[model samples]
Target: MNTRILKSCLLGAMLVLGGCASGLTGETYSRDEARAPQTVRMGTVESVRLVQIEGTKTNIGTGAGAVVGGVAGSSIGGGRGSIITGVLGAVAGGMAGAAAEEGITRNQGIEITVREDGGQTRAYVQEVDPNMSFAPGERVRVLTVNGTSRVSK
Candidate 1:
């Protein structure tokens, strides 16, 4: 492959991998969640802790990376040597791509420990929303739908 074509392929793969990330913030909802009924409970935040939200794992990232790597590696030598390097590149690229996808999509989150009005204590974890901030003793609402829960002011 030409150098220009190789660069373009790599760039396209990166874009595809980046686009696979989805929002996990309290204010963000999946299409299935829209207009759905949710159980709402009133609570007071007892504590707030910072946390890390792991990224998604999908075949798209690994496959894209492998293709890019295989092409790059195949360009390294002639004939049989190219084949060997291509295979090795695909394996290494797959692993690297998975890690890159995770790192790229990883998010900062919060663990909110709340005391419900009904006297039940629970903790909710969600990706941090830039527009929202939680502090100890703040009033909050715990909303749950289809067993997924979120905390909001």
Candidate 2:
């Protein structure tokens, strides 16, 4: 009876965990509002100024969490505890890897000032592809990137 109950509980827990990690969160944004051009090749950096340095630091919390959880779990019953702990470790490791990758990347933005020929003046790089070629003294058209923003010229 106890074994049966344990099995059922484990199965239920597995199902619940699976559902949570399946990206079931209902969140959607319209393409018009979230779509941006994929790339920009000819735009020049208008106003070359370092806005701010953004840094992503890799955190070993996930892996560390997994290792600790595994060790603790392994010390439990003998077989059952070990199995449960291993699964928990795996999940922790996955989370840690994802966080590390996210933290390792960095992005910096610059305000671009564009000047077209014949005195046509317009600025569109700020928040968009401010880094796109504007020459502070040149001209360009920028495009968006998957919703972020980028140069189009």
Per-prediction RMSD in angstroms?
A: 1.2, 11.2
What's the CA error at residue 90 for candidate 2, in Å? Answer: 1.6
- Residues 94-137 of candidate 2: C-alpha lDDT, one tens digit per residue: 47544543443333445554443445433442322423333454
**Residue 153 of model 1: what lDDT?**
86
Alpha-carbon runs more than 4 Å astray in model 2: 1-77, 118-153
lDDT tens string, model 1, 1-153?
457766987898889977887888888889899899999999999999999998878887788778778777788888899999989988888777778778888899999999999999999899999899999999999999888999988
Candidate 1 Cα errors over 4 Å, as ranges: none
TM-score of predicted structure 2: 0.33
lDDT of 2 at 146: 56
